[model samples]
Target chain A: MFLPGRRLSLVLGTALAVGAFAWFFASGERNIPDTEGGLDGNGQAGVFAAAAGAALVSGLVLSSLTNALRLPGKPLEIGLDGLNGATYLQALSGLVAEVSRSWRRQIQQYFSG
Target chain B: MAVLVSDYFIPAIFALVLFSLWFAGRDRVEREAHQRAVGISMTALGIANLAVQVINSVYFRPRPFVQYELDLLFYRPTDSSFPANPAALTFAIATGVWGGNRRVGAALYALAVLYGLSRVYAGVFYPSDILAGAAIGVVVALLVSKLFLLLEPLPTIVLRLARRLYLA
Candidate 1:
């Protein structure tokens, strides 16, 4: 028996640790340069910083708006269960009919206009 | 350690995406939705990365290794350093998943942060670069996820195909 939850948690924990260690040590490196002029010596760090901040703020706002609206969630089920040739053909035909109906409606609207 | 953080971490980030996909696949009910979310998120990430590239072209930032003599663990890139590409992609994927699954999303976000910080540690990118990348990624993910909901038929078609192929 394999425990996916436990394994995933372990992996996530390790990744976080590695990332933390890197950030901590990287900050202390002597070769690192001053942030006064930005990384490229072109003073673009300010611009990048502003853009990054804007993006974060916008993302948060959008996420909250969507959540508050109580948007319907989609299903994410994926597996190879209950599929056979008959069902495949049935689905295919249904799809074709749906496409044909949509096209016919568009054509009718175009000609009537 | 520097080499591991800078060079090896790249593959690890990719592995994280794969793991995320697999984890989503395990969801018997929401697998298709999760897959759709992943697709939309990746598409958004791709577009954002292209946008970042355009920005980088306008503003060229030199890598830390290029400015100072440091023991670089990886090959020095001649690209713009203001917005890190890897950080952008990882964060985009993480944020996209987060919209669908909170637990996994949180984990992925943590990984994205780690990846961003590691790039700085590796001396290939500046902290600002990582920050910009992450911001772009998150915004794109949020916007794309919302936009994708309007195109519900697209995912329905994909789900139908997956079902036909016995892939649920």
Candidate 2:
């Protein structure tokens, strides 16, 4: 079984996404909003939302194809599920549960004592 | 932003994507099963986000601070900020992590805050939009994550189909 802290791929993913976003800004490429919008066909919100939607669709389609090819094999698949990612929610949940457990134990001890 | 440093769109989206990646990356289950779970969960989130976007296009709304010239950290998009689809997508990814992967959820939550604050700062999106989007995303993620687990029997059926089709 892979150790929780041993996972580095998730950290990489977080870094990549953040780096990409920052790069977009730091690159300083002036985004001249194309007046002639394509899919959105209206304003800034439409365009941004459309872009986000496109990203989602494209990512899904690509992921399916990757799966068919077994690109990541089993390890990669786990990573994609969002469960394998080395995030802090697990620790927090553990901490919360631990606190509750400890609190309960304390109360039980008090009553027993 | 009128909200805070954490209330931005870019940071939120970034957090979402990263959290999803991180959560899905930490499976203790069999590799193939884990992979399939991640793939399905991500695809669901992606589709939900996309579908919501299309709906938004048809149902256009306005931004919160569009009327006033405000100093901000990011560029604002012109669209109805209600039902923040991006936030919803992130939340879905976060819930999918659940007990199976906590790191991913934390990352996603962090990203949610960033995305929400960024939108407000950019002078696009109302608090309502961010709230709705985040709530929806969380609900969807929870539902879809369980759905993936339920589909455990699918791989066998799919394999049988592949054999019949001679694609195996």
Candidate 3:
């Protein structure tokens, strides 16, 4: 049972961890004497894996800490949007049509001017 | 600044921004929309990578640092420099988010441009490569977003399942 606020914190932590590792790998830890320190194929993969692990650990720690803090009221649940299959299809179709209409209008305006 | 940005800072920001959006929004509706953008961006990124690979296999261009002696800010890469991979990837993400949220999308676009310029400044890629990469990314993202829209109910179904597991 993950609280909404904790879940948010977890994601934020993961993002930060991943970003920090990427920067560190590409910039801070880049000066190797023998090699020019460019990211080769293997190096890139290692960086990604390491960053992911770091993100997971950091996210978990942040979420656990947030849970321990136990902020005042219960957070709101992130419920479903209630858009079923049919409604979902309808919404997409409407969006496409709207985009098309807008494009047409823009084209007309361009030609008119 | 150019070295830091060209090396990894901007790309990292892209990931961070996308991750933040994935879990953002007040209600399920908004959150779902944001997630959809992130999904689209990820798919576009995959496609962009494939495109870059295909192009690299077909056409090989030397890196700017390799072609001429210049003050190189970053390390030398062995990969072909025809279509800048970072540029394509960042632009793909920007375009993907643009379809869902214009403001964020525009901001991403700006960052993408900056990333391309930074790469050029670092002597990793040519202007032509960056332009080509940006074009490929934008086109791929637009096409993927349209395709996702066409495949409507399928995405919604997947999202619902993820939501059930609290993974969405």
In terms of lDDT, the best-performing candidate is: 3
User: What TM value does chain B of candidate 1 have?
Assistant: 0.85
Sort candidate 2 into its docking category: incorrect
Ten contiguous residues with the weakest lDDT in model 1 chain B: B7-16
lDDT of 2 by residue, B11-103 (tens): 345434433442233233433343344454465567668767876888877666676677655445665666776567656655654434466
Candidate number 2, chain A TM-score: 0.39
Encode model 3's per-residue lDDT on B76-127: one tens digit a residue.
6778998988888889999999877788999999989988888888788999
Per-residue alpha-carbon lDDT of candidate 1 for residues B1-168, written as tens digits (9 for 90 to 100): 453454334434444453345335554567766777666666776777787878888999899988887876555666789888777777887888787677777887887788777778777898999999989988888888878888888877877776544345
- Compute the interface RMSD for candidate 2: 14.8
- Which residue pairs overlap in candidate 3's backbone? none
Encode model 3's per-residue lDDT on A1-113: one tens digit a residue.
13455568578767757786666776665534225645643365357557755864575455445543443322233232322211222333444676799999999999999
Q: What is the lDDT of residue B114 in candidate 1?
A: 80
Instruction: Return the top candidate by DockQ.
Output: 1
DockQ of each: 0.11, 0.03, 0.06
How good is chain A of candidate 1, measured by TM-score? 0.26
Which scores better on TM-score, 2 or 3?
Answer: 3
**TM-score against truth, every candidate:** 0.57, 0.50, 0.70
Q: How well docked is model 3, in DockQ terms?
A: 0.06
